[model samples]
Target: MCAKNILWIMCDQLRFDYLSCAGHPYLQTPNIDALANRGVRFSRAYVQSPICGPSRMSFYTGRYVRSHGSTWNGVPLRVGEPTLGDHLSEIGVRTALIGKTHMRADTEGMARLGIDPESLIGVQVAQCGFEPYERDDGLHPDGPYAPDPAYDDYLRDRGFGGSNPWEQWANSAQGEDGDILSGWLLAHADKPARVPEAHSETAYMTNRAMAFIREAKADGRPWCAHLSYIKPHWPYIVPAPYHDMYGANQVVPVVRSGREKENPHPLYASYMEERFSRVFARPGVRERVIPAYMGLIRQIDDHVGRLAAFLEEEGLTDSTMIVFTSDHGDYLGDHWLGEKELFHEVSVKIPLIVVDPSRDADATRGTVTDALVEAIDLAPTFLDAFGGKAKPHVLEGRSLLPLLRGSPDWTRRAVISEYDYSQRRARVDHDVPVADCRMTMVFDGRWKLVHVEGMRPMLYDLESDPEEFVDLGDDPACEAERARLLGLMFAWARNPANRITMSEEQIAAAYDTELDANILIGYWDEAEVDAARKARGDAE
Candidate 1:
C-alpha cells in the first residue's frame, strides 16, 4: 500500500463512450476497458474546457481555465502559476512529460518582465510544468508548423533519412502514383500512414514512457510520468493493421440529420455551416475519416495494454496508481460539428478511469460512478493519493479521494466547461461582436445547459435526451430547471480567483500581516489620519 508512483496516461480527443466498458458499440478497446474493470470508471467525467491546451492546463494545474488564463491552444500559461509538476517535485516525486503538452511559452510576459526565457523555471512553465524525460509535443517535422528537432534527430539516428520525415513518412501515405499523400489533408484520411508501425509517433512516445517508468522504478523514487499519446487527434490516419482495422461499417451511425439544421440553435447552426463542420457532415467524408480515427484509438488501447504488461513484468503494478483520461473529446461529426470547440458532450465529456492501488480502493474496484468530476480534479487527486495536500492558495480543484474510497455522494453536483473563440477568425455567422463570441457548458448529470455570450442559452434534458438533439432552453415547461442550472454555472464561474492566482482567503492572509502598511483612500479624512494610524497597529 506504499504506492506513491503515479502513471498518468492520457489520449488526445478520446470520447467518453468509445471503450467497450463505456457501451461503445463499435470499438472494442479491451485494454482500456480492463483498466476500468479493475478500477473506477467515472461515467460523467468532464473537462474544464473542450480544447486541448486549456483543458490540459486545467488538468496539470488543478485550476479552472479562468484561474490559469491559458484560454486557448497556443495561449501561453502565465508564468509563476503552480502546477502538479511543481507540487510533486517539491515532494520528492519526479514529474516528466513523455508526449504532447500543446503548451506555448509566454515569451511576451518573459520579455516584458525581464525573466530569462532559457532558464529552467521558464522552460518548466512553458512545458505545462513537466520536466522532459523525452519531450515531444506531437508536432514534429511538420505540424501546426512548429520546428521540432528532437524527434527529427531520433529519426535520423534510426536511419529514417529525411529533412522532414514527419510529413514525408509519419503523416504521409505512399500513393500508387508514387506521390505523397499528406495526412494533414482530409483527402488522405483513408490512406495508411507511410511511417512504419514501429516508428509511428504513438509507438515512439510509448517507448519513451516505458523507458522512463523503468528508469524511475530502478531508483525507487516516487515519480509521475505523463504518458500522453498524440494520436486519435487529427490527420486521422494510422499505421499497418490499425489503418485497415475498421471502416464505415464499424462506425456508429451519424448522430445528426437534417432535423438539427432545421431548427438549429443560432450558435449551433452557425457552427454546422462552417467549412470544417460542413466537410465532416458531407457524405463519404466521415466514411473515409472516422475509421482512421478509430484506428488511432485502437492502437492507443494496445499500447495501454503494453504498459500494463510492462508494469506487471516489472512488479511495479502493485505500487503504481494508473489513471487514464483525455484532455477532451472530439466532435468527429457529432451534431454536425467537425472538431471540439462547442460545448457538446462529444467535445467536453471524456472517459476517466482511475486505478488506485491501495486498500481503500479495493471495494470500489470495477465499479462505475456518476460523480461529476472535472479535469482540474486530477492534480489534486494525485496529490491526495500520495498523502499530500493541495496548497489551498494555489489549486482550485477538489480532490477525488472520497470518491476513490467509495464515498456515496460528491461535493460537486455539476461539471463545467468553457471555450473562448473570440480570437479565432472563423466566421460565427451571428450579429454578435467577435469579442463577445464565447461558449460555456454546465452538465448536472441529468440536465445540461450551453451558454454562449450574446445569445440565448441552449438547454437539454439529458436524462431523456442523452444524445442532446432537443433544445429546451425556451421551453416553458423547462424554464425553472434552466434557471437552476444557469444559477449553478454563474456561481461556479464567479470564483474570485478567475484571472487571478491568489484566492480571497490567501489574499486576506497575506494582507493580514501587512496591516502596518495599510494606507487607504476615502476611509478616513486627512485630519484623522494620525489618530487612525495610532488606533490601528500601524502606529510608529
Candidate 2:
C-alpha cells in the first residue's frame, strides 16, 4: 500500500474511558467513536512517560525516556535527532503542527535533583522538524486580561475580581464560555456570552487546523498535520452549549474512598484530596464543573466532525491516515485529580484511534485491539507509513503498521512509563522537600508495579482492582507477583544502559556544560537543552 497523508489529532489530558467507543455511557464523542468504529482502537495505549512533554517527545522520537533522555518537560529536543516529522519531511512528506505543543516544556522540579535546568525542556515540536506555520505557545482561548482593553472591560462586565491573571481570565463561569475560569464566576449569575462568539480554544484550534488542511490539500503535498487541543486539561471549561450538555447527576464520579489504603503510594491520598477538592472548593462547584468537562469532550467531537466531514468532502477520506489520541489522561475526579502526570489508569491511559486509508474497510475497520502499546510506537509507525526507517538507537517501541494491517501476532505484552519531577513541590514542611519525587512504572497485561524512589512501592492487580484501589505490594499473598514485577522493573532499568549510570558532571558535560542550575524549568526549554545534550554524544 502507498503511504498516505497523516493527520494526528491530540487532545489535552483526556481519559481513554471518556469516549463512548471506549464504553463511556455519558460522553458524546460521535466523531471519535465513529473513527473507533471504522478503524482500530487500542484499549491499552499508554505514554512512554506520564508527563506531557516527555510523552509527546517520545512519540516523535520513537524512544523511551531513558533513550532520548527527555524524562521531563522544558528540555529542548536536539536539532539533529531524527523525529517522526524529521524523517517524514526528509523523505517527501510535508509536516505541519498547530495548537498546543506541550513538547516545548520541561518537568518543573529538576533543579533540586541536580539535573540541569536547560535540559528540562529538552525536545520540542519545532526541533521535531515541523515548520511553525502558526503557534500559540499554549495560551488559553480566553485572552489574557491586560492585552485587550475590550477583554478587561469584558472581565469587569462579568464582575471578575481575581488578582491572578490566569485566575481572572480562566473562569468560564464569568462569561458565555461559562466552562472557563472567568466564565465560571459569571456563568449562572451574570450570563457573559453577550459580547463575543464564545471562542473556544478547542474549537478555534480545530477551525485553524481545518484551514491548514485545506491549504495543504490544495498545495498538493502529502501532509502530516498535528492539531493538539488544550482542554479538558485544567479548570475544566467549555462554552455555553457544551457546559450544559451533560448532567452532573448522570456523570459518574471517580470511584474513590475505599481504595486509598490499598496501593498507597507516598502522598497518594493527599494528592487526590488536593486535586479533586480544589475545583469544588467553592460550594456546589462540581455540579457546575463536571458537566463542563464532558462538554469539552463533546466540543472536541463537534470540531472533529468538521475535520471528518472535510475529509469526505475533499475526497481525501480514503487517502489520509488520521490518528487521534492524547498526551495523557486527566484523572478528572478519579483519585480526585484533574490533571495528568500519574501512574493510575485514568492518568496514564489514552484513547488511540488509527485509520489507515489503505486497509480493507472490513478487515482493519472498526476493530479493537487489547495490546499494551506506548506513545513511542507512533514514531516508528509514521516512519514505516512514510517510507522512512527507525533510527538504530536502542528504541523501546515498535511500529503499528502491521497491527493496522491486521497482523495476528502483533501485540505488546507490557509497557513502561517513566517520570522524574524531583523539583517542584507544594511547600517545604519540617525541612523536607515537599514536591521532590521520582517514579518509574511497569505494567504488564494483568499487573502493575509503581516504584517511587524514596517511598514504598505500589503494586496493583488490575484485573481484580481495575480502579487500582488495592495496594498489594506488602500483601503476603502477592509476594510472588511482587517479585515478578520487581524483576520486570530491574529488566527495564538494565535495558537502557545510559540511563542506569551518569554523574551530574557527566550529564553537564553531555549538555556541553551549558545548562544553568538556577532556572525554573518547563518542557519547551527542556527540549532545547536535550537536543544540545544529545548532540554532545560521547564527547562528554
Candidate 3:
C-alpha cells in the first residue's frame, strides 16, 4: 500500500466535554463536531501525561515519559530518540511541523557528543525529528525561558506599533481606565484582546499551515503536517466578537463544591491549597473567564473548518488522514483544581477523532467507542496510515488502525498517564525532594488508581462514583482490586529499557564473523564462496 498525506491537528488544553459532540450544554463547535460525526471518536482517550511537554514528547516518540526522560516542560528530549517524523520518513512520507512542539533541545547531549547544535541534522534531532515549516512554542516576547522570536517578529512587521507587540497588541486588552491590561495577568480574563481577529495568532497559524499544505502538495510527495495550536491554554482572553459571544449564563455550574475539601487526600489537599487552584474557586471568577475560554475554543473550531474546506476544495480530503486531539485536557475547575496534572476524567480524558477515508474504515464512520486509548497511539497510527513498519523496540504504543476500522478485538485494556511535578520548580516550592514527587495514573473503565512515589495511594471506584468524590484506597472491600492493579503496574515497570535499535550494518556485521568469512577454506574450497556471496547479494 502507498502512503497518504496525514493531517495531525493538536489543540492545546482543550477539554473533552466542551464540544457539542462531547455534550457541552451551550457550545456548538460545529466544525470540530462535524469531524467527530464523520469519523470515529474515542470517548476515553487519555494522554500519557497530564502536562504539556511530557505528554507531547510521548506523542511524538510513541514512548512513555518514563522511557523518554523528558518529564516536564523545558526538560530536554534525549538526543537520537526516534519520533513520528523519523518513522514516517522511513516510509517516504514528508513530515513538517507548523506550530508549537514544546521541544527543549538537548544542548548538553549534543555538546557531549561533539554535535553542532545549529547544524541541519542537529536541528532535526533537537526538534523531535520534524522538518520545521514554522516553529512556535507560544512563549511571548518577555517570556522567562525563551521568547517566540518568530511570532514576535511577525507581529512587529504587521505594524502592531508597540515595544513588545506580542504582549501589547496580540495578548493585552483595554481596561476601564483605557490602559492596556495584559492577558498574562489572570485578573484580565474577561477583557477583550486588543488585536484584530485577522491578525491574531490563531489566524496567522492557520494560514501558515495552509501555505505548507499548498507547497507540499505541489512537490507531489506524500506528507504529514502537524498543525499544533496553542490557545485556551491561559491568558484567557479573545478578540472582538468572540469575547462577547457568551457570558455569565453560558458558564456551567462548576463540577465541585466545598465537600471535596473535607478530608481530602494528601495530594488533593496540597493542590487545593495552591494559589492558582484557590483563585478559580473565588466568586465571579468562573463566570468571568468561561466566556473567553469558550471563545478560544470557538475560534479553534472555525479554523478547523477552514482547514477542512481547503482539503476538500483542493481535492485532498480523500487522500489524507485527519486526526484531531489535544496534548492534555484543562480542568476548568472540575475538581476544584485549576490546571491539569491529575487522574480525574476532567483533567486527563481528551477528545480523539480519526477520519480514515479508506473504504475499509467506512464501517466505523461516525461511531463512538468507549475503548481505552492513549496519546502515544498517535505515532503508530500515523505509521500504519503511511504504510510504515513500526519498530517494536522503539515504539511502545500499538496502532489504532485495527480499532479504527471496526475490528472487534482491542490491543490495549488499561491506559496509563503519569506526571512528575518535581521538576515544576516554581510549583514545587515546598521542601519535598524531587525523587519522591511523582505520580502515575492507571485506570480501566470501572476503577482508577493513583500511585504516588512517596505518598498515600488514591483509588476511585469509577463504576459507583464516576465523579471520584470518594477515595476507596483505604476501603477494605477494594483491597483485592487494588492489589490486582498494583501488580499490573509493577509488571509494566519490569520491562526492558534498552534504547538501541541496531543499524543495518550492525546486523550484517553480526553474520560476518571470522568463521563465516573463512568458510571458503572449509571442505568445499573457493567454489562455494562465490555462490555464498551471490546468495547474500554481495557478488562481484
Candidate 4:
C-alpha cells in the first residue's frame, strides 16, 4: 500500500479514563469513541514524563526525557535532537504544527553553533523541526509572559477589545453581579466563559488544523499535521453551551483517600500540601471544576466530529491515519494531588487511539490492547507509516506497526518513566539538592516501583492494591519486589542511549573492518595478521 497522510491529534491534560469508550460513566464523547471503534485503543499507555514539556519532547523525538535533556517546561530541547518532522520530512512528507508543542528553542545552543534564529533552517530547528503553521503554547497570561499576539489579533478583529483579550474575554467568566471572574481561580469554573463557542481555543485550533489540511491537499503532498488542542487544561472553563452541559451531579467520584495523607512520602506530602492540591482536595472542589473540565473535553469531541466530516468530504478519510492521544493527564484530586508530577496511573497514563487507514490494520481495528505503550512510540509510528525505518541509534521507541498488523510477538516486560523536580516547590521544601531532585518509575504489568533520589522508594502491588491507596516503600515485606524493579531500572539506565553516531550493523562490521583498514590494536605480528586474513579468505 502507498504511504498515507497522518493526522496526529493531541489534547492537553486529558485523562485516560474520562472518555466514554474508556468506561467513563457519564462523559459522552461519541466522536472520539468512533475513532476508538475504527482503530486500536491502547489501555495502558504512559508518558515519558508526567509533565507537559518533557512528555511532549518525548513524543516529538521518540526518546526518553533523560535522553532528550529537556527535563521540564521552558527547558530548551537541544538544537541537534532529531524530531518527528525531521524524520518524516526526510522521506518527502510535509510535516506541520498547527497548535501547542510547549517547545522552547535552544537559543544558547544555536548561538554556539552559529545558527541564526531567523534563518529558514534555524526556524525549523527552533520549532522542534516542524514547519509551524501557527505555534501557540496556549498559556497566554497578561503580564510577565507575552500573550499570543496572533490569537489576540484574531479576537480583536472579531470585536473583543481588551489589553489581554485571551485572559479577559476567552478565559474569564461573568459573575452574577456583573463582575469578571477569572477562570484561573477555581471558584469561577462553574460559570461559562465570555467567548462564544465558535471562537474558543479548541474550536480555533480545529479550524487551523482543517485549514492546514486543505492547503496540504492543494499542494498534493503527503502530510503529517499535528493538531494539538490546548484545552481541558487549567483555567478550566469552556465557552457557552459546553460549560453548562455538565453539572456537579455529572462529575465522577474523586479517587483520593485520607489514608494517603497519613505519613505519606516526604515528596508526596509536599505535593499534597501544594496550593493546587489542597484546593482540589476541598470537599466540593472536584464537583465544581471537573464538570467544566469535562465540558472542555466535550467541546473537543464535537470539533473532532467536525474535522472527521471535513476529511470525509475532502475524500481524505481513506488516505489519512488519525492518532488521538494526550501529552499527559490531570490528577483532578487523585491521590491527593492536583497536578501530574507523580507516577500514579491517573497522572501518567493517557488515552491513545490509532486509526490506521491501511487494510493491513483491519484485524486490530475496534480492538483494545493492554500493551504497555509509551508516548515516545508515536514518533516512530508516524515514521513507519511514511515508509521509513526507525533509526535505532537515535529513536529509542520501537515501531507499533508490527502490533497494528496483528503480530503477536510484541511483548514488553517493563515500562519506564522519569520525573525531574528540580524546578518544583517540592524540591525546595524537601531541601533536596538540584542534582538529587529526580525520580524514576518502573512498572512491570503487576508491580510499580518509584525510586526517588536520596529518599525511600515507593512500591505498589497493583494486583492487590490497584487503586495505589497504600505505599509499601517502607514496608519490609516487599523488599524483594523493590530490589527486582530497581535492577530493571538500573539496567535501563545503563543503556548507552547517547551512543547514537553508529548503527548496530556498523558496530558489528567495525570488528573486521578496522583490522582491514590496518588499525590493528591486538595484532601480535605480521604473520598473525596474515593468518587472520587467510582465515577470513581475504588472502585468496
Q: Write the per-residue lDDT of candidate 3 for residues 1-540, one digit (tens) a residue.
A: 333899899989999988889999998799998998778999999998998899999999999888998998888999888888888888788899988888888889898998886888788888789998888776566553346557777877878767777788778899878899989876787778989988887888899999999999999989999998888788788887788888889898888856677787777887876777878888888888888999999998999999999999999998888999988887777788888887889888899999987888888998999988999888988888888765667788888888888898885658888888775442365556887788888897788989987666899988888788888877899899899888878777787345448744566779755445664445375667767766667632
- Candidate 4: stretches off by over 4 Å: 141-147, 515-540
Candidate 2 lDDT, tens digit per residue, 274-331? Answer: 5344564344555665676777788888888989998899888888888999989866
CA lDDT of 50 in candidate 2? 77
Off by over 4 Å in 3: 1-3, 144-148, 423-431, 496-499, 502-540
Q: Between the candidate structures 2 and 4, which one is better when assessed by TM-score?
A: 4
- Candidate 4's displacement at residue 469, Å, is 0.3
* Candidate 4 lDDT, 1-540, residue by residue in tens: 545799999999999999999999999999999999999999999999999899999999999988999998888899899999888989999999988888888989999999999998899999989998988776665422224547778899999878778888889998889788999999889889999989888888889999999999999989999998888888898898988899899887778788898899999999988898889888998999999999999999999999999999999999999999999999998898897889999999999999989999999999999999888888888888889866888898888888787999998888989999998788899899998999999999889999999999999998999999999998999999999999999999999479877888889977667666778779999999888888878555
lDDT scores in order: 0.82, 0.68, 0.84, 0.89
Ranking by TM-score: 4, 3, 1, 2
Best by lDDT: 4
| Strongest candidate by TM-score | 4
- Full-model lDDT, candidate 4: 0.89
The alpha-carbon lDDT assigned to residue 16 of candidate 3 equals: 90
Q: What TM-score, computed on C-alpha atoms, does each candidate reach?
A: 0.91, 0.78, 0.92, 0.96
Candidate 3, poorest ten consecutive residues by summed lDDT: 423-432
